[model samples]
Target chain A: MKATILYEGKHQWTVFGRDPDKPEKIIDTNQYLVSTPSRALLIDPGGIEIFSSMLAATLHHVSVDQITDLFASHQDPDIISSLGLWDQVLPNARLHSPWLWESFIRHFGLNNIEYVPLPDDGGTIDLGDLSLQLVPAHYLHSSGNFNIYDPQAKILFSGDVGAALEADGAPMFVDDFDEHIPKMKMFHQRWMPSNRAKNDWVSRVRRLDVDILAPQHGRLYRGADVKRFLDWFEALEVGVGV
Target chain B: MARIKDERLAEGEVLVSVTVIAAELSEVMKIAKEISIGAKNAKAIAARAGDKARGFQPITNFIDDMARHTLTMVRQIDQEALSVSRICSQEIRTNDAKRRMHDVIRRVEHPSLLKSFQGVVTDIDARLIALRREFDKRLDHLAELLDSINSDMRAATAISSSCRVEASRAEEFREGLGVVADNLEQAVEVIKKHVKECSSRLQHAQRLKQAIYKK
Candidate 1:
């Protein structure tokens, strides 16, 4: 229901979430929008219910016409179900999503907007001034998953990779990493499917120079807390649902 | 009312639109059948009033013929509306199938299957558009038919007033026939009033269709 600018510069990074008004049974999602002067790319633009809220929130930061691209990390109602709604307003906008889920996500109603598929290996997305890397985080939770890494800002929009299922109105960033482990433990263990894939994603992301590890749900990990999350997640026995 | 405000109803909007139009057509069809029955009753009443009610006979017969024609047009519209509903339900079913097989479809490297999916989607869209245009044209035609029926009802009402005056000459023999002529006039007016209401609804539906699909 609100858009908070996490990073501000010529290229601004805004997080649209932390809704106290979100319905009881729905999972709260963090929709990340990276805005440039001429173009903007929205990552994981939430679902059908929060569409009006998302559009209203984004309008506070950038005009609806300014959003030139969209990225859906994977196909889940919570992640990208708003694709159908987006088709009406942003008819000219291009969708940067995993190629695997093109036909699947189309069932969510994607007739107007063009789909620019992200290869299985992942790739880079170009805004007018800045370009973000779409790194493959396959099987982190969804089979064809990705994490958007903004090298200039050192922020990794990690999709649901480090997501914690905390209550609504939770803090935007974790101050105490140890205290936050309980909120994320079950989500990572249960929702995340493969241990091999988890370790591979963690190891690969550890190599990145990340200042902020922003997940689609719960609070983000900032600076020192980013390393704390990686270290804790590395040893955590994930893929328990497997 | 607003032009595709929910945006999420993008393709699914066709289903909502068609359902609303079909329901309106059904209501109109029901009334058309009632009007037909009213005309049949009027014809029987006119036969009892022999020479005195002879003037009422031709007006009642015209009403009867118009009722039949109206019913035929209504039935035609209803069938087309039913087809739209059938198409919508079928699309919903096929879309569900596609969603379930998405992961399976990805695993299997069959280009033909993906092409077939695209083909199906395109065909459905085309069919929906054609059906909508047909509904729009029929709605216009129905409105025109209702106007003609209203005009005919007015003429019958005027003629019935004169017949009532003529029958009043033989108070003993044709007094009963005056009442029959009044009943026949009332039946025509009832049909005309209903047809006008139905015509107004059709106009509203046309406006709604424009808001949903037109740029």
Candidate 2:
């Protein structure tokens, strides 16, 4: 598993992904950790198959008890299927997820953790010292989806919105917007079912002062490439397979 | 002395075996109900025969009692088997969680961070231990229930043999009474077969649970 420090300030944002030791056939995923001094929040903790690797990688930064909160962008297995295992370890932790997914997400084994349901309009996750905004991105893929935006860090944890289906060991950040289009095109077209929802998300994200557009899969879009992705995605016709 | 092989069974296997026990018990319950109905029919025939089937009347009463007892025991065993399945599922989840946490703790190179995991790991370890204990206790209870069913089947076999002896004295209704005896014996045999299979599954699941927790 690779851990990259995406932002370093009073609080830190570290992305853990690109696990070389991941078992064959399972999709690779990127898990984000936002660590304050006394509390930490884990975002989109991956499936059950990668729980050990995710937990081991997380220990490099914040200890187990320090992980006070968990956030699931939606109820996708690749996103939070490890909730049962996490429920065992982080007994006191609160899980912040879409209100619509509260009952569905509990099916993933969430007995001990408190489920702090986020309304459809989205809400804020108060990490004691820092507060992160949960931006709604409904119908972009999942009916009840959200993206975590850090205004101070100028970064958007876009869940599956900016996700691309790339080959294994792909670069962490999009270096060439034109070349990356093919990797992302098929995934967006097939997975993102609503063009209206895609345009809505694009317009909403455009208003945010985002320097980094982090996704849960493949590479992230940063700086000029972030704008390039928005332009390309806004123009592309999605949900074509229907 | 020969040593027992250290066999590893997945939690799903144990759960499936326990669930199969319930299904087998359900079959036993159906057979028991048939036995009860057969006993009622035998009683009716004995009443029609009057003094000719006088001795068979007591035997019919005994068969009815056995069938009722078997039905009650099967219901109890079914409930216990389902409980065992639930406990097994919970124990497997807790065990897997504990194993993953241990892996994380082992990989933590930083001493202070490792120390921070201690409290939570201890808490999880305690939960795993409690679940294992509950699982073992419930499994033992299920074994006892299966044992009681086995004991009831033994009594049933004896009553079935007695039923045959009384059937020969029925005179003109000899063939009718004889058929009733045969049906009772056959029902007992079917129940015995299902009970044996259920007991075998329970034992296998118990051995697997012991082997898993022994480590």
Candidate 3:
């Protein structure tokens, strides 16, 4: 599956599926575009205030009716607050999220879409050549947390774990581990309190052989920086100096 | 011996003459007038003494009672003072805890940049609410204790004042007794001196009569 990376405003990265016979798909913090041979999926459409403009701009070349799925990682405002708005735009779309966070979602009062329950262990959802695996990140931050890993691209879409802050219009990819470590350390110290969960997450990610680490908040990491982050995360778990 | 008897008879005659002169109507009238004046002076002195004693007794008693009660009240005041001090210390401790809880709530409500995630907001809010409720309960308990203690202090103060007044009155009454005793002692000494002079005169007259009879 061919993919076109779109730089959605507000420091978000959207990977759009670029096949002629399929609709588009987006990912991460903002609107994402994923296209199969006959249908498409939009993951984590943002807040309702910006959804319409973002949808119009991002899907300028693609039709909204072709979008088939609206998937959310959890029930946080930044992640699934826009699902209600997306439900109005895409009538035929099914909303997929972990069952643990369903009650939290109902707070938004959205009722038109289907709520698909993802298993605890995780499973793969195939759209022709593109297969997205739902990796459980439970207890890392929230009970219903999960990460999406695209096997074909060797890209792990981390929800908040590997997130970092960047200036507006900054590069999306991490060019240096030395510069990123401070931001990552700050994030881990403030957000992730449980060392056991951090170690577990590190072990899980080490086995994946990920080439690209895409998080919702920060820049993506490629090559040795990803491995270095895992090592540092593991050291944090073991009470070793980084 | 005859000369001695004659001299003794002369002394006896003088003694008899003096006695007869005192027994005369005019002399008796004069003695009666002197006696009446003396009795009138004694009565006047006695009346003054009685007035002084009556005035002094209640004052002395009041002073003595006041002193005793004041002493007891002073002791109680010391105890209540200690209690007040203890209550103040406890109230300060409770207030400190309340301030610390407020600080904790403020800290949780506005977490650091790392916890700026959307999900952490809900957790912080819930925790802050719980902390605030706990702080409120503690403060309410402290306030109630303070109110009760304050009322107790006021009652203790009133009792302390009454005890002090009683103690003062007791001391005054005790001093009055000393003054009355001193005045009574002076009056008794004056009466004793007059009776001694009268007995000496009667003894002289008896000696003269014995000489005259022998002559």
Candidate 4:
């Protein structure tokens, strides 16, 4: 697994993905960890198959006990199927997920950790020293979904909003916005599910002071490319699977 | 490496044994109900025979009581078997988590971080111990229930013998009373067969539990 440090200020943001040992069939996913001095929050901890790799990569940075909280952007397996395993390791941690997915997500066997459900309009996760906002992205793909925005780091952990189905060894960040269009276009059109929801999400994200747009899959958009993604997504007619 | 494989195999064995016990006990329950019905029919036949079968009246009541007792014991076994199965699944999960946590601990090189991981391992260890204790307690209760059923069913053969002796005196109703005795004996045999199989399965599971925990 590759670990990229997106921000290394007072509160650090690291992305773990591109596992060299991942099985051929399963989709590649990116998991982000936001850590403060005394606390850490793991976002979208991936599936059950990749748990060992995820844990080993995470342990290289923070201790198991230091992971005080977990965040699930949606109920998708690729997003949070590792919750049950995480429930076993992090005895004192709390899971922050969508309120609509509380009962549904619990089916993945959650017995140890506390479930802190996020309300429809969105909420905040306080890491003692740093606070991250849970921005609403409902129907961008899932009926109940969210994107984590770290104001301190100016990075938006977009769940599946800007995801692209790329090859195994794709670059971590988008270097060319025009060339990356084809890689992301089909995924957004088929999976986003609603044009109204897409426009709403785009408008809401444009209002935030985001420097890096880190998605759950494929490459992230940074600097000028972040604006380019918003402009392109706003005009694109999604939910084209009808 | 062989020890680890055996432990993993034992983990699955415990769950399978409890499930088989529950399924077999359900068969006992069905046959026990049939015996109760057979007892009722014999009672009616004895009443019709009146003075001729006066010796057989009390035997029918005994058959009914035995069937009822077997039913009660089998139901308790079924419930206990289900509870044990659930606890076994929980223990398996806790043990697997402990193993994985240790794997993580071994991979870490930082001395300070290793200490923090140890805290998580300590908590997992305590939980695994509690689950194992709970599982053992449940298994002991299950064994007691199985023993009670076993002892109770052993009396069926003697009761069937008494029924045969009394049925011979029924005179006109002798054929009917004999058929009732035969059905009771058949039902008891089926119940006893399943009960014995369940006992053997539970004993096997208990042995595996002891072997796994002794280490």
Candidate 5:
């Protein structure tokens, strides 16, 4: 599978289930398009107003019908409020998420799309040549949360855990871990307060040989810095998490 | 009879005039002495009364010492007055020596002849003037001293009054302590009575047990 990184400022998206070079950051949504030889997948496709222009730009190269599956990591407004909008744009796309967050999404009045309950334990969903593994991040910040890890690309799409509040202009790769670690530390302390959850996450990541750690909020971290962050995260006092 | 008649006539006329004049001078001197003695006596009485007031011992001591010194001064002034009176009377009685003395006194008293005797008279007059000035100054000083003493007495009286007030407060405090002591004693007595009653009850219980065992 081929990968193309589409970034707007510090925000980045890895396009694997769709055509490369279509990076979208509209209004409040950050969209990642992953395409295989036959089908395509869009993870956390932002709100309608935000991704509309970028979608237009993306469709210029590939058709909207190419999108076969849509994955929302959690049920927050900024994360999956655009699910209905994505359903309208790609009617055949299946909404894959944890079963726990299905009712939460129904609360948003999105009914037409098929809600595929991803397993609580780690499981894989075939997307042509690449497979998306649903890694459980239960109680990291929310009760029903998971992340997609593509072993083919060695990329882990961490939902919110390693995320920072970096602006769009920040470095896309993990080369600037010194500057980004403080932001990540602050975000973790505020959002992820449980030491047990943090340790569980660190152990999960340590098992995966990740080349890229892309979070929903910040720039992607790559290489040994990813391991360093995991080690640092595991060693931090639990109290500091909150 | 002629000699007795002559002696009586002289004694009744010239001698009587001289004696009356001397008596008048003596009366003046006596009045001066009385004034001085009255002032000295007043000081002594105040000193003695002040000394007897045990609370004002410092003030009394000071007044006693001042009174003794003042008595000595009054005595000296009385002596001086007596000397002046004696000189005036002695001069009056020596009628035979008067003509010769009058010649010397006339020269001394005469302002023109006094020029020759200027040093002596001037010295005497200056001394008298100085004495009068000193007396005036001393009177003013005494008045000021008395005023200061009065003010000090008023201050002492105020202080003594405050001390009395403080003493009353201390008495009240002591009375409060007495009440506390009485309450404590009452509590102790109550505790002792309870202990005695408990002891008697225990003894009665022991006797009842003995009777029951005997039965």
Candidate 6:
């Protein structure tokens, strides 16, 4: 139940999961928390299986009342199936997600929450003083997905865009980018149906001043590795399944 | 009867039962606090009554020390309640995970996904039994704490009765110290009553805890 702080002071960001409470058979997921003094947001809060562990972990950082918003990149269970439990805790909290997933994600339970739908082109989530930008990331894997960008922190929460499926009890960050290719190659090729979407996303992110490229699954890409990830993804072929 | 579909213990029942036990323990804390106050008052009365209450002086210190011990034990019991709450919450999670396996088994069509689901369910079943065993061990620890508190009260009672008898030797001074001994006896009786009641309530909570170990 440790929330490892990525950035402290001013606007803070933390990465949670990869602990004993998370079972071995289940795929590893990285849950993010970005907070200022008055407001906080939970990114891809994870499935029902780890809800208590997540809540207990988050409480160590901030109380339930401080959580102002929840961000779901798209409607995937590993992404946000704990919405039902979250709804119980943060009944008045706003859920920020793509408009395409408004109806589909309701199946994860949205009775009390105010669903703030993001446009197809993506939009900004205002946390009072600090504003978070949602970068459009359609068909990287999910048909209508988006990525969270914190300009001040220079971190891009790339959703499933630069994801890798490391085995359970694996490293939190990429130690060897080239060696990690075999882990992510087949997953991307089969999951990302359109080669056009993959290239478009890679090209768009290259223009942004990103210091950290974080994803929902597997290790983060930091410093020069961010550029390395773009180069690899741009050259790789996806959706052929072969 | 078709075995009553939801025979499994509900989480809310465990929560409410724990809440009641915590409240009963609070009563014991309150009585311990009163006993401390009585000891302070008796010590003052002992000094004024002079040699007639000479034997009573040491016994007042005993009462004060016992009261302090009781308060410390109650704090430990509060910790026990917290441990029970944590274990109960874990049980709820195990139950939820088990139910989810059944859902996955029903809906997932892919052979790989279905096989994975089966593995998860098997893992969760083992986890549920382990959680119950852990819960039982915590309850046993809680029972030991209650027994320790009872032992402290009995020692305090033996000291208290000796002081009650000392109040009879005052002769001319007996007229004034009579009220003091009566107040001390009443405080002792109050402590005994609440401690006995709280011990029983804790045992009831422990039984309810035992009932929840069902598969």
Candidate 3 residue lDDT tens string, A40-84: 666765554444344544444344455677778777776777665
Question: What lDDT is reached at residue A127 by model 2?
Answer: 96
Better of 4 and 6 by TM-score: 4
Q: Candidates ranked by lDDT, best first?
A: 4, 2, 6, 1, 5, 3
Clashing pairs in 2: none
TM-score of 1: 0.60
> What C-alpha RMSD separates each model from the true structure?
13.4, 2.1, 39.2, 2.3, 51.6, 18.3
Q: Write the per-residue lDDT of candidate 4 for residues B14-104, one digit (tens) a residue.
A: 8999889999998899998999999999999999999998989998998899889989988888999999999898888788777777766
lDDT of 2 by residue, B96-126 (tens): 7887888776776766767777887788778
- Give lDDT: candidate 3, residue B17: 32
* Worst 10-residue lDDT window, candidate 5 chain B: B92-101
Poorly placed runs, candidate 3 (over 4 Å): A1-13, A16-31, A237-242, B1-215
**Tens digit of per-residue lDDT, candidate 6, span A45-84:** 9987777667656655665568889999999999999887
Q: What is the DockQ of candidate 6?
A: 0.01
TM-score of chain B of 1: 0.57
Candidate 2, residue B190: how far the Cα is off, in Å: 1.4
Q: Write the per-residue lDDT of candidate 1 for residues A94-170, one digit (tens) a residue.
A: 99999999999998877679999889998899896798998899888889989999989999999987899987788
**Model 3 interface CAPRI class:** incorrect
Q: Give the runs in model 1 whose Cα sits over 4 Å from its true position.
A: B1-135, B138-215
Off by over 4 Å in 5: A1-30, A238-242, B1-215
Models sorted by DockQ, best on top: 2, 4, 1, 6, 3, 5
Q: TM-score for all predictions?
A: 0.60, 0.94, 0.46, 0.93, 0.46, 0.55
Best by DockQ: 2
Candidate lDDT scores, in order, read 0.73, 0.87, 0.51, 0.88, 0.52, 0.77
List DockQ for all candidates.
0.03, 0.72, 0.00, 0.57, 0.00, 0.01
Worst 10 residues of 4 chain A by lDDT: A82-91
* lDDT by residue for model 5 (A1-242), tens: 12346432222335422212224442222446666646667777654333333444344334455667788888877677656545444545688888888888866446457889877785876776667788898777777888888776677888777777754444555676676677777777777768898898888778997987777665667788788778877876644642
lDDT of 5 by residue, B48-146 (tens): 544332333343343334334433433443343344333323322222122222333342323443233224234334433454344334333433432
